[model samples]
Target chain A: MTTDSLKYLWQFALLCLLQVLIFNHLNLGGYVNPFPYIYLILILPISIGRIQLLLVGFLLGLTVDVFSDTGGLHAAATTLMAFYRPLYLKAQSPREGYESAAVPHIKTFGFAWFLPYAALMVIIHHTALFYLEVFRFSEFFHTLLKTLLSSTLTLAFIFLAEYLFVSTRRRR
Target chain B: MRNVLLFIYRNHVFFVFLLLEFVCFWLIVRNNNFHRGSVLSSSNRLVGNVYELNNNVTEYFRLKTVNEELALENAALRSLLNESKYISSGRKGEVKDSVARQHYTYIPAKVVNNSTDRRNNYLTINRGILQGVEPEMAVLSSEGIVGIVKDVSKNYASVISVLHQNSSISAKLKDSGYIGSLVWDGRDPQVAQLMDIPNHVELAEGMLIQTSGFSSMFPAGINIGKVKEFHVDEGDNFHSIDVELLTNMSTVSMVYVVDNLMRMEQIELEEQAQTDDD
Candidate 1:
C-alpha cells in the first residue's frame, strides 16, 4: 500500500476509536453530540475514487452507530455527506483549482476555505441525522436547534484537534 | 443488453451509494420482527458486553445513591411482609406465603445502557430470556414505574422507557378512581401527559395517579405520577392533564421486571370470551 493510504488507515482507526470511546460519552448537556468522525471523510485526498470514499464513509458511520446504539442514522448521514463532498468542492473551487494529491484541512487550504466547507458538511450531516432520528415535522424547531448546536460544537472540536496536533510542514 | 451494460458501468458508483443508503435506512427505520437484523443494537452480545464492562466501572461511582435506594426498598418490603402476616384470616402462614408469591414475580436487573435525551428513549438491562424477562413485562424502580420491556435477547433486554413518544400506560386517579392513559410528549423527561379523562372527573393538582390494573402488565395501585396541572380545550369534553412522573428516569440504575404469572391464562380467557360474544 502507498504511504497516503497507510496514513489514512491509521487516521481512520484513531478517529473511530476516539469517536466511539471518548466522544460518545461526552453527553454535553444532552443536545450536542460532537461527531468527529466526519473528519475522516473531510480529510480524504481530493483525487480518491468515489467508490472508495463512499465505502469508507459507510464503514466509518456504521462503526460509530454500533458503539452509540443509534442504529444506522450515522451511516445514512455520513454517506450522504460523502456524496456531496465533490459538489461542495466544485462550488467553491479556488482560482487555480485543487491539486490532485492535496488533502482538505484547515492548514492546507487556509482557515477561510476550510471553515465554510466544514460548516456546509456539518450542516448537511446534522440536518439529515437529527431529522431522521426524530422523524417528525412537529418538532422541526427543536430538531433545527439540535442540528445547529451540534454542528457548531463539532466544528469547534475539529478545529481544536487540527490546531493542536497537525504539523505546519504538512500544509505545504 | 450492450446499452444497459454501458449505462450500468458508467453509473455504478451512484447506484452503489443508493444501494448502501437503502440498506441503512431499512436498518434504522424498520422495527425488527425477529431480532436478527439488529446485531449492533445494545441488546446484542458484543455491544451489550462492552456496555456491561463500562457499567462495571462506573457503577462504583453511584454506590452511595444506589445503596440508599436499595435500603428504602428493603424497608418497604419489610412493612409489606408484616402487613400480610397480620391480615391473614386464620389461614396457615405457608398458604399465605404461596398466595403472595403467585401474584407477581420480580426479576432484578441492572441497567447497562440508558438514554433519556432521545425522542424514543430505551434502556438496556443485564437480564434477558435466561432470567425469564419477556417482552411487554412491566419494569419498575423503587420510586415508581420505569417502563415496559420491549425486546429480550440471550443475555440482555431492552425497555421502552416512559419517556418515549409511543409509550402509553393505563392509569387512574387514586382517590376518585377516574381512569385515564399516561403518555409522554417527548419534551421533558420529568413530565408526561395523562389523557382521556372526562371534564367532570374532578382532577386537582397534586392528585395521585396509579396503575388501574386493567392491563395485565402492571398490577393495580403501582404509583405512576401526580397531576401537575390540567386544562380543558374549548369545545372538548376531555381534560388534558399533565403529570409529574415519580421515577427519576435519569438516575435509575436498578429496576425490577414484573412478570405477571397469569398473563397467558388471562389473555386466553379474554380471547375465548371475545369469540363467544361474536
Candidate 2:
C-alpha cells in the first residue's frame, strides 16, 4: 500500500487503542465523557476510496470492542457509520474540499461547514453505540436522554481535541 | 443499465446512513434485562484508563472534599470509641478487650471505573472478591450507599450504581419505619423516587430515608437520602416522594464495600421464605 495510506491506518489503529484502553473507562459522572479520539476516523484522508474508508471505520470500531470485551456492540455501530461517511462528506459539499495538503479542520472547513458535519457524525456514532450497548427501549425516553446528552458532550470534546493537537500545514 | 448503475451510485451515501441508523436503533430496542459485568462495560478498561488519568488531574480538586469527609468520619469513629470504652473496660475478665470492640469493618476502595452518563451505569472498584468483597455486598462512600456488588473477579468487582434506572433498594423513613423501593428516574442523580410507602405515614421534605434492614445488601440505618418533594396521587393510597441523594455521584472516589458477617444467614432465611411462599 502507499506510504500515506499506511501512515493514516497506523494513526487510526493507535487512536482506536487509546480510545479502548483509556477513554472507554472514564465515566465522568452521569452522561459526561470525553471522546475526542473518534475524530481520527472522521478527518481521515479523502484519497482512499469511500467504500474502503467505511470498511476501515467498521474494523477500527470492532477492534475497540475486542479489547473492551464488548462483543459486537461497537462493531455493529461502527460498520453502519462506515456506510454513512460519504453523506457526511456530501453535506459539507458547500466547500467542495479544503484547499490544502492538511486534512479538513474547523480552521479549514470553516465554522459554517464544519459544525454541522461534526455534530451530525458524532450524533450518528453516539446513537449507534448507545443503542447497541443497551439493546433496549423499555425505558425509551431515559435512554434517549443519555444518547443525546452524551453525544453532545462527546462532539464538543472532539472539537476541543482537534483544535489543540491537529496542526494544519497549508502551503497553498 | 447505465442509468440504473448511476442511480445506485448517486444514492449510496443515503442508503449507508439509513442502514447504520437502523442497526443502532435496533440494538437499543432489543436489550431488556440488566445483568452484571463491571469489567467489560461503559467504564470498560479503556474508560478506566481515562478515569485514572482524569483522576490525576482532578485528584487535587477532590483532596479538600475528601479531607473534610475523612475528618467527619474520624470524629464519628472517635466518639464511638469513647462510648464503647465502657463496654470494653467493663468486661475485663470473660471477654477480651478486642472482642468487645465493634466489628463493623470498612475496606477502602478506589473506583477505577465508574459511569453515571449511561441509562444503567456501574462502577468497578480496585478491591474485589480477593479483598473480602463478594457479590450482593453493599458498597458505600463516606456519604452513603453506592450500590450492590453485581459481579466480582480476582481483584475487581462491578457495582450497580444506585443512580441506575433499574436499581431497586429497600428504603424507609428513619423515624416511621415506612418501607419502599428506592428507584431512580434516570433523569437526575440527585433525585430518586421512593415507591410503595403509604401516604398515611407522615413525611416532610427534609425527612431522612435509611436502609430498612430488609435486605442483606445494605446494613440497617445507613443514611440514604432525604425527601425532596412529595405528592399524593389522587385516589391512590401511596405517597410518591422525590428524595435528594446525599452522595455527590459526580465525583465519587474512595468507597467501602461492606460484607455483613451474617449475610448468608439472612439471605438463606429470606430465600427459604420465598420458597415457602411458592
Candidate 3:
C-alpha cells in the first residue's frame, strides 16, 4: 500500500478505537448519544470503487455494532449510506464522481452542499439505529427526538474532528 | 462473459444495498424473540466483554466527579441521619428484631455503563459478585429505589434500570393505600407512569408514593416518587398518572443494594408449588 492508503487505514483504525473506547460508553442523557463511529464511513477516500465502499461501510459498521451490542442496526444504516453515495453525489452535480485528486473536505464539496450532505447521512443513520433498538413505533415522538438530538451531536463531532485532525489535502 | 461481469460490477452498489437491507431486516426480526436473547444473554459474551472494557475507561475518567458527588451526598446523609434520630425521639414502642436494620449495608457503585439512550435500558455497575452483591438485590441511591439485579457474574452484573419499559415497581400512594405499577413510557427520565389505579380513587399531584412490599424485589416504604400530574384517561376506568421520580438516575453515583434475607426460601417455596401444580 502507498503512504496515502496507509495513513487512511491508520486513521480508520484510530477512529474505531476512539469511538468504541470513549463515545460508546457515553449516554449523555436520554437524548444525547454521540455517535463518532460514523466517522469511519464518512471519510473514506473517493478513489475507492463504489462496490468496495459498500463492502467497507458494512464491515466498519458491523465491527462497531458487534462491539456495542447494537447488532445489525449500524450495518443496515451504513450500507444504505454507501449505496446512496452516488445518488447524493449526483444531486450535487459539481462534485459528481469527485476525483481522487480532490479531498472530500468542506473546501472540495463546497460549503453549500457539504453541511447538508453530511447532515442527511448522519440523520438517516441515527434514525435507523435508534429505531431498530426500540423496534417499535409505540413512542415515535420520543425516539424521533432522540435521533435528532444525537444526530446533531454526531454531526458536530464529525465536523470538529475533521477540521482539527484530518488535513484537507489529497495524497499523491 | 467479461461484459456480464462488468455490467454486474457497475450495478454492484444497488445489489449490495439490497443485500445488506435484507440481511439486516432478518436479524432485526430474529432479535425480537422474547423467550430469550436480550442484552445479557450468553450469546452476547463477546460484545459484553467489549462493553466491559469500554466501561472501564469511561468510569476511570468519572472518578473525580463521583468523589465530589459522594462528598456532597455524605454531608446530606449526615443531616438525614440526624433527622431520623429526631423523628424517632421518645418513641420506645416495642420494636421487633430486624437484621435489615443491622446487616443491610450499602457500598457506593458508580454506574460504569448505562443505556438511557435505548428503550429498554440496562445499567452496569462497578461492583459485582466478588463484592458480595447477588442477583435480585435492590439497587438504590439516597433519593429512591433504582432497580433489582437480574444477572450476575464474578466481577460484574447488569441492572435493568427503572427507566426500562419492562420494569414494573410495586408502588402505592402515601396518602391512600392504592397500589399500581410504576413504569417508564420510554421517554423522559424524570417522568414515569403509575398505572392500574381505579378512577373511583382520588389522586392528587405532589403526593408521595412508596413501595408496597408486594414483591420480594424491594422493601416496604421505599420512596418511589411523587405524583406530577394525574387524571382518568378519556373514557377509561383507570387513572393515567405521571410521576416525577425522586432519584436522578441519570447522575446517580453511589447506591445502596438491598438484599431480602428470606428471598431464597420464598423463591424455592414458590418454585416447589409451581412444580407440584404442573
Question: Of the candidates shown, which would achieve the greatest TM-score relative to the real structure?
Answer: 1
The best-first sequence of candidates by TM-score reads 1, 3, 2
Model 3, range A1-172, lDDT digits (tens) per residue? 4986787778767877777666765677567878877776666665667878888778777766544445477788888777776677667656345565655666566566678878988887888788877767887888888888899999999889767875556443
lDDT of 2 at A159: 78
* Every prediction: chain A TM-score: 0.93, 0.84, 0.88
Worst 10 residues of 1 chain B by lDDT: B29-38
Of the candidates numbered 1 and 2, which has the greater lDDT value? 1
**Residue-by-residue lDDT tens digits, candidate 2, B77-194:** 8878746555545554664566674535677888766656555667767776668877778899888789877666666666778977568999989988888999986667778899
What candidate 1 gets wrong by more than 4 Å, as runs, is A1-31, A95-97, B32-37, B83-101, B271-278
Task: Give the per-residue lDDT of model 3 (tens digit) for B1-278.
Answer: 99999988887778777887887676545544433334433124454566667666766777897788778778877876746555455767645555335434565665655655566666666666678778768898777988766555565666768987668888999888898989998767788999999999887789999989878768788898999998876899999999999988776656777767777777889889999999
The superposed Cα distance between candidate 1 and the true structure at residue B2, in angstroms, equals 3.1
Comparing to the true complex, what docking class would candidate 2 get? Answer: incorrect
lDDT of 2 by residue, A43-124 (tens): 8764546667666776676566534434446657676666666666655554555443545577666767678777777777
Query: What DockQ do you compute for every candidate structure?
Result: 0.54, 0.22, 0.46
Ranking by DockQ: 1, 3, 2
Error of 2 at B167 (Å): 1.0
**Over the stretch B224-264, how does candidate 1's per-residue lDDT look in tens digits?**
98999999999999999999999988889999999999999
Question: For every model shown, what is its TM-score relative to the native structure?
Answer: 0.89, 0.73, 0.74
Model 2: residues with Cα > 4 Å off, grouped in runs? A1-35, A47-76, A87-116, A129-172, B1-39, B42-57, B82-105, B273-278
How would you class the docking of model 1?
Answer: medium
Q: Against the true structure, candidate 3 has what lDDT?
A: 0.73
